[model samples]
Target: MTASGRSAALYRTVWRWHFWAGLIVAPFLLVLATTGAIYLFNDELNDAVYPELRFVPPAARTVPVSRMIGAALTAHPGAVSRVDLPAAPDRPAVVFVAPAGGGEPLRVSVDPGSGRVLGSLVYARTLVAWAEELHGSLMIGTVGDRIVELAACWTLVLLVTGAILWCPRGRWRAAGVLWPRLTGTGRRFWRELHGPVGLWTGALIGFLILTGLPWAGVSGDLLQRGSAALGVGYPASFRTHAAPESLPMKTALGTAPWTLEAAPMPRSHAGHAGHEAPLPTDDAGAIAGVDRVTALLAAEGMTGGYRLFLPGDATGVYTAYTYPDRPEGQRTIYVDRYRFARIGPEVRFADYGWVGRATELGVQIHMGNYFGRANQLLMLVPCVGIWLLVVSGVAMWWKRRPRGRVGAPPPISGTRFAGLVAALAVAGAVLPLFGASLLVLGAADLLAGMWRGRVGDAAASGIG
Candidate 1:
């Protein structure tokens, strides 16, 4: 093929891939962008929507943490599973309680000064929680999680193919290539809007996808297993020789740091045989444990709000977890219920390996926790831009599509086709879910082509 011919074939091949990937994942991308944009300001949004439950008047004097827990437990019928100390004097303390009879956990808000139960409700029913469920799992459990992961993987494909198609040919000018040509109409106008907007937002979109993948089902699992195999997983200091047969942090505690969710829970040696112990089994004992840990954390300069997950059983340990607005302030410490010694070394951001630290920082930025309001606004740009890109893409397709046909880019043939297929196969190997869906879609496309060819042949013979 001539140089021009090769260039044309490349563009056509890239366009075909971009078109199919976008068409498949556009709705999912829209849903993700919308939910993510809302979740960026989850705390602020929750405060606004439920001020009674989330805020309190600033006071010079505040009640003890034990009093807050006691008030919440008395008001709600459950064991106090975890308590979140307010970040500020003006914010209410939140206590999560699991019912003795078994049911959804309740989040109780308490006034800091008076130890009054401000309000209580099911945690899962909260707006922010609902949004998170939808974003992560579409509220449909594991199946939804897989679907979201697949969409995320294909989104990477879309970005790569889009970038290839966006490459400038001939003279790179400011008109249609650099900026949208607003003066044009119909397909021309939509094309200008789509290409330039995509070019501007593509890198940010790719970053978001890459960062978000650590939370995905398949990819996240792969990352964890891979990191563990390489011995760069959670810090070794976070683990102890004696592993407790306790629930995972996510199960025992309502929320935990992402890196430590799967890490084994350290056993409390307090009540174990031949162990020096003053195990706390009663409410008062639990309260004293909370007091001791709270003071210890404060003395150690662990500030900016922390959660204390109360020991559930005799073997259970008190877990103090705090993921502050700053990534560097992230801390997770487990204290033996009776003996009250640290379970393992205090797990902090500094303890993470380079890969773990990078993932944590990226997640912080992705979730708008790194720089607060400025970070939220900066992240919002790509989210809103993605919505616009989806709209412009659909509009362009609508304007240029034929009367009764799907307007996919023309298929390539011979070597170009084989190369594109191989590229997709490689992508699939890296992203299993995306690769699986790619195979299914490719099969469907092939079968559809065969069916159409048979129909055309039959019609031609009849005409003859």
Candidate 2:
């Protein structure tokens, strides 16, 4: 084939891959975009919806954090699991309660001054929580999580193939390349819109996907394993001592810094390991430890809105966790319940290894925290753009596709097919779920081809 012919063939093959992948993953992408856009403004939305729970009048003197928790527990029927101190004096303190009878955790808000219970609601039923659930797992647990992860992986494939298809052949034009040609009609209009919009939003969408992969089931595990193997995942201090085998901070408490989610919890030693003498193991000592830790955190400038998860058991440590709007304020400090000594270096954004730091920055930006409201609005552009792309792509297909046909581009065979397979194999290796789906799809394709061949032979033989 001529060079031009080879280029054309390669373009067609990429277009075919893009078509199939988009057709399969567009609905899930739409869901992710919608939920993610909503989640971007989660705090604003929640505050708007429930002002009574989120806001409070500024007061000269506020009650103690312990008093707020006491009022919340007195008003709600559950054990206090965690408390979110208000970032500002005007905001109500939020207390997370785990129901003794087994149900979704409850979020109770308390007035800072009077220690009055403002209101309480089930955590899972909150609007922000629901949006989070839909975004992460589609409210279907592990199966939904896998499906979402697979869709995300395939979206990367879509972006890659779409970029290839969008490459300019000749001199670049303003219309259909940089901006959609508004003057066009029918499939022309949709094509113009889809291609340009995809180009504009592709980078942000890819960043979002890459950052979110750390939270996914299979991909997250792989990323963690890979990071550990490279010695850049958890903090170096995590391996310096024989820490107790405790649940992850996120698992034990409600929230933790992403980098320390898998870091082992350090145990409180009784005057051992070259540390100060441990405090008493009684209830009074626990209370004193809480006060001492809170004071230390305040002295260390652990800002408001940080959470202090009280030690749940004899060996449990007091975890002060916070992921503030500013990435630099992000900190996760674990203090021994007995000695009140920090378990590790106060883990902060600065303490993360290079890979971990990069991930943290990506996560902060992804969560719209890097630049506050501006960040949220900027990220929303890609979310809205992605939705537009999906809609326009579907409309274009509908206009051009023959009736009753799947509208897939012609399949490539020979060397082109081999190249496609090789590309998919590499993607699959990195994204295991995507790889599994590819194997399943390939098997189905092979079976369908055999079936069609059998039917054709049967018809010919009968005529013969």
Q: Top TM-score: which candidate number? A: 2
- Every model's Cα RMSD, please? 3.7, 4.0
| Clashes per candidate (backbone, < 3 Å) | 0, 0
Total backbone collisions, model 1: 0
In TM-score terms, candidate 2 sits at 0.91
The positional error of residue 464 in candidate 1, measured at the CA in angstroms, is 12
Error of 1 at 89 (Å): 2.0
In candidate 2, stretches whose alpha carbon ends up further than 4 angstroms from where it belongs are 100-102, 170-172, 240-244, 269-289, 417-421, 460-464
Give the clashing residue pairs of candidate 1, or none: none
Instruction: Note the Cα lDDT for every prediction shown.
Output: 0.80, 0.80
Compute each candidate's TM-score over C-alphas: 0.90, 0.91
In model 2, pairs of residues that clash are: none
